[model samples]
Target: MTSNTAMIPSFTPSMNPSTKGTDHGVEDGVTGEKLLFFNYHEYSVKNYRLIGENTEDFHEQALIITHFPNFHVPRDSNTFEGTRIVRISRYFKGVGVFVPQFSPYLPGTEPAAIFGDDDTNAKFIVQGEYMGQFFGTSSYSPLSEYLTEKEFREIVEEINVQLRDAYNSWSLINLLLFVLDLLSFWIMSDLIHSLSKRKLDALFNFIDTRNKSLEKRGIKIISPRDSGFLSVCIVSTVKT
Candidate 1:
């Protein structure tokens, strides 16, 4: 299974009420709330594995296997969204996953992208779920700020070994298929980089053109001091 990991008790938007409004989204008759798990919860999910079909729609039927410490739950749970489903793995004893509801929020400017609304909370939950995949169980900690550079490299090496072993187990045909996948990824990355550069160039050029237009209109476009001096001269001349 393709897996990844993230740091838990992850950084969250400040708890100030002013920032709370930015955390929610509403679209398509649905509302989304950010769910952040504190480390001291009575029970926290340790391992979470999500298995789904390679379909464009994620709402299709899927299985989520997880391990919850100090909690006992049934093996199979109810389905969700009338289509998406979940069940606990017999191998892992934990509560069945409950899919969080999310709908994109449009801020009156740019419409939110599909599934972008719940991305933050999704990250927070997934981090607590998959810490073992990236960092070894013994070495992983929510207090990553205490880890030294050498310790961080050791964790990375451990993850790399796991990835290498998985790659080495593939058959020759699968290896070739993997190569094609890498090429496609590279091509897409290059295409995105090129588009980003073009957009940045266009934005800079527009700023430069606007500055020139202001200069032609006798508006100093550089330091605020220059503009202030010109304003003072105008004021003095009017008083004289």
Candidate 2:
């Protein structure tokens, strides 16, 4: 977090044959706001809104989690209460797809990190300090709740395993296509409904990760009076 943040997370092309320095996760002594990069393009959304037009209530109910302050996105217009979408805390270990719940949705061996001393239901990110914020929370991001290091690790482990399997299986690609396809063929039908809660969640999580990684390089210095101004950036996407 220096005055020039970009200079720190640089990918060197010269003098790299033997020299070394800290990686992108840490800050050199520059001075930017304590950054929690959210590259909206590298990650995908994993939640109910991906399916179709979410109910208006769903918009109000969804939550987003981040490692830093002032970073978030709104839900798509068609989601239900149980839907989820979120980013991982930088402190999370195991950086892959995962599901914390122990059920049919659960998988085994993903990327995860353990943070803090307590062992409550917390998840750690490999990138930043631990703060158990999660998406779709009513009382703020999920990380605000004090998750013990153990509980957080367990949740991250669960998510990483799932993400790893999905990547190995190329399921993230398939699932995105599936969502787009399902949304397309049946989308025009007013009766279209969500395929499964698990599927939706996976999509949200995927998109969020993409956001953090790919979009981190760019930040808009918005006018304070209208912090909500809209700007557009072109991006490629899965074919319909």
Candidate 3:
């Protein structure tokens, strides 16, 4: 669905250093260099009322589409090289087709003019000019050259379904792991308690046998307070 309204892209002179009047190889009217520019288009999408609810959904969908078979691996990890399909899926997601009420416009247009800076305008203008050149001006649509709106929607929905399935699978795995961890902890605690009890029982048995032997020899060990005396008597008896 091509719009009848022609999008006239414009870029600031600062964006194109060639447009600046040079004085002895140095650009004239040059100010301090800007490292980063605020992107109005990104801000608009992030704060859009219609897309707010689906923003997280779209991000999850993008994640699944980009990393389909490799969900187990972290995205920042260098192990997985992006394939052609992955790159295509990422591009499709970035196109904002699934984002509700998203209207793609060339630079210096309504949203861009309202929210974008020089850098944002320059960026979009370059992209639009390139696309216009690649695809003929008469048949250029902002959506896609190959896929229709319906086809694109179908693909997005299919990817979303896959994403949901993956989330469910991961949730189940996490639950199983948690249960296993609890079970293991319980078993270890029980084993340690059992071992401690056995050792304590053996120590008490040894003390009882010693007490009985002392009693048979007319040396009656009465209370825990007499442990020092018992030690002395035992040492004396051992020496004898």
Candidate that scores best on lDDT: 2
List all candidate RMSDs to the true structure.
27.0, 19.2, 34.0
Residue range 1-240, candidate 2, lDDT tens digits: 343211223333121111122233433455432232222211111232412343222232222222233333333422212222223322221232232221111111111111222224233212111123222211122333333345435544444455344444345655665667676785523343333434446644654564455344332221211222121111211111
Q: Candidate 1, after superposition: displacement of residue 21 in Å? A: 22
Q: What is the lDDT of candidate 3?
A: 0.26
Pick the winner on lDDT between candidates 2 and 3.
Answer: 2
* Candidate 2 residue spans exceeding 4 A from truth: 1-67, 73-145, 170-240
Would you estimate the TM-scores of all the predictions? 0.16, 0.22, 0.21
C-alpha lDDT values of all predictions: 0.24, 0.29, 0.26
The local distance difference test score of model 2 is 0.29
Which candidate, 1 or 2, has the higher TM-score?
2
lDDT for each residue of candidate 3 in 35-123, tens digit (9 for 90 to 100): 11111221111211122233222121110011012222355654222211111112112223332111222212221122222322232
Ranking by TM-score: 2, 3, 1
Specify the highest-TM-score model's number: 2
For residues 57-77, write the lDDT of model 1, one tens digit per residue.
222212112222111223353
Supply candidate 2's per-residue lDDT for 207: 41
94, model 1: CA deviation in Å? Answer: 39
